[model samples]
Target: MTEKNYLTQKFEADRSRLRGVAYRMLGSLPEAEDAVQEAWLRLSRADTSGVDNLSAWLTTVTSRVCLDMLRSKKSRREDALLEGGPEPSVSGEDAIERETILADSVGLALLVVLQSLNPAERIAFVLHDLFDMPFEQIAPIVDRTPDAARQLASRARRRVRGGDVLDTAQTAQKSVVDAFLLASRTGDMAGLMAVLDPSVTVRVDAFAGGGQSRELQGADTVANFYNGLAQTARTALVDGAIGAVVAPLGKLYVVLDIRIENGKVVEITAVGDPDRLASAEVSVV
Candidate 1:
């Protein structure tokens, strides 16, 4: 058999798995098929002489294609948002057929949650958690370190489980926040960094800062902001989410609305406005 023939046969053999990966990444039959086709086109044009595992290489290529499509879709959605109107919807027989295909392939609830996640998080979570792909494999695809890739999947996992996290996941989140509080109290920069997402963001309301509302981004910046602070902060459940609160002499002074993903702190909102504080249901954990 010719080399081209052999390659074609191998690709055909892996087509099912590739389609599955793309479908999960995109959550749309048409887009997934397009991504798979793109992968095949790229494979036909590239040098596969050094590739030891054709299946793995194909999976990676297909995943990359899906990621690009997802990013482009996200960009367009953002543009639509700025334009101030909702995008038109599809309907009739075509829409029904598409919906039937998707519903048969994936659970509606899971699909809804997956659609809520960002492109990178969706790819990481679907690949690692769903396809059993490793973080080492996912890291390069998402342009992140292995640890960060792991965190990406971790964050996605939490979101998939929804707002009322399972006891185990909630316990895990609490530990991360507790460590963060310890690090903050002791001015431990490295400790804080360890539990914080690389792109963590912190926003403080005017009431929280006595008149100046501000936002901080990046782990280093957030860690710096928290270093040597929160000495009186207590671990609390902010609206059923594990967070921290500062109440001196039994009067609520500030509430830290911490959001954790994949065992790391991703976002923190400090609320100090009396009206805001009055509405939030907070209790020390």
Candidate 2:
């Protein structure tokens, strides 16, 4: 076979792995697929005589594409700023299962924290921490000095560590999610109130420039907001647990995996966005 045919075969063989890397970096399957495709096209058009490692070369190309998309998305989110309430629901169990399988490395909480990072930091962290790539190689992909890449990884690590509500706190959060779901689905306001902590705070992502996006302080307010939501939306079970999808709201769908503490709901997070939900699963339960 010709060099071109050999390269084509190699590309096909490596596409799936490359796409997984891209998805973890970007937190969007469609974007990841696009990035991999773009990388393949670039490979096809470039002179390959000097290319020593095809897999590494493709990974570099895909990483750069995903970084570009991340930057573009950040710009768009900043420009089109909307009143973020809750994430909209796309589908049910089958949809989530498909997304989880294709993503390969993403989890709900990780995806949320990823949104806070710049493209370079995100790429560096994913490469060094997730894929176990050496800093020597990651440096060039992110166009930074090896020391700088290390710092980027350090900063990303700090952010993740700080935002982690998992670890020892997961059981508490899971209990809250379970009780909240049971109460909401059954219209048991008393049961819901019984589980909520008096100091509970609900903050919706309003996409606002500064300040708490949508903050509801005190258990009463948080309870009331959820009670209202439960009354309006249709509830169903996904992956053997209760979930709800509400239309006409930005956070149209939310899934809760409760964390129980000394018997009260200390934290109740909204799991609606596919990426966020995926990441949350990693950090939480």
Candidate 3:
């Protein structure tokens, strides 16, 4: 077999894993795809005659591409907010899985919450903590001392594990989601209010952007948000689940996740566009 054939075979074998890592790191399917494509272009141009580990080289390239994208996206979000524009909607199946994993994976959540670090730190923490890559290997990838990478990972762990409220908060969040949906579809505002904490927060991720900027604190505010929705939109209980999609007249408007805590509603997070909605199990008419 020719050298080109060997490289092609190796790339085909590792494509899925590369895509998975890129997806997890970037959280957007399209972004991940773009990152991987760029990585492939870099690989095609590299002098592979002496390269011993093609997989590692491809992964390193992919990681750098993803890190660049994340940094660019972060800056864009900051600029958009400054200009009074809405935050960019989370797009693609990869993003959906990232949100679900962040909510569900104990280790993944810890790494995600450490986004305050520089890209190097974030990459080190994810590699060491989540993927179990050795500090020595990670050091080359991030161009840091192995000892420094170890320290970064340790600091990230401490920062994430410091919070003891994760367990209770997650449980309360799930309950809140279930109850709020139930009450909204049944027109049981009282029931909805019952699950909500008095100091609840309600925010809508609207498409026209900047729909509701202020935090809707208190049960009354939460109840009123739903009341306005009910008045302007029609809602139907998504069969087989405790969630609803609110459509304006006949158009799909928002997909809502209701959170209940201690049998009381505590939070309502609304995604106004189907494209932006992370939770997929919605019954759309």
TM-scores for every predicted model: 0.51, 0.59, 0.53
Question: Arrange candidates by TM-score, highest first: which order?
Answer: 2, 3, 1
Error of model 3, residue 200, in angstroms: 7.8
User: Model 1 clash pairs?
Assistant: 154-262
Residue 201 alpha-carbon offset, candidate 3, angstroms? 8.6
Can you tell me which runs of candidate 2 are displaced by over 4 Å? 74-100, 103-105, 163-261, 266-285
lDDT of each: 0.77, 0.62, 0.58
Compose the digit string of candidate 1's lDDT tens values, residues 111-196. 54566578999999999988998999899999999999999998888766544534887789889988999999899999999999
Candidate 3 per-residue lDDT over residues 1-285, each given as its tens digit: 865567667776877677667665664445656677667666666798787888888888888877787777741122212222112344677566554453233322232343335566667776787777789888877778999989888866655444233355554454555455557656787876777789888766655235644457888877766652443222222322344455332234565555555666566566665455433433212
Roughly what TM-score does model 3 have, to 2 decimal places?
0.53
The CA-based lDDT of model 2 is what?
0.62
Worst 10 residues of 2 by lDDT: 78-87
Give lDDT for model 1. Answer: 0.77
Best by lDDT: 1
| Winner by lDDT between candidate 3 and candidate 1 | 1
Q: Which candidate number would show the highest TM-score if scored against the true structure?
A: 2
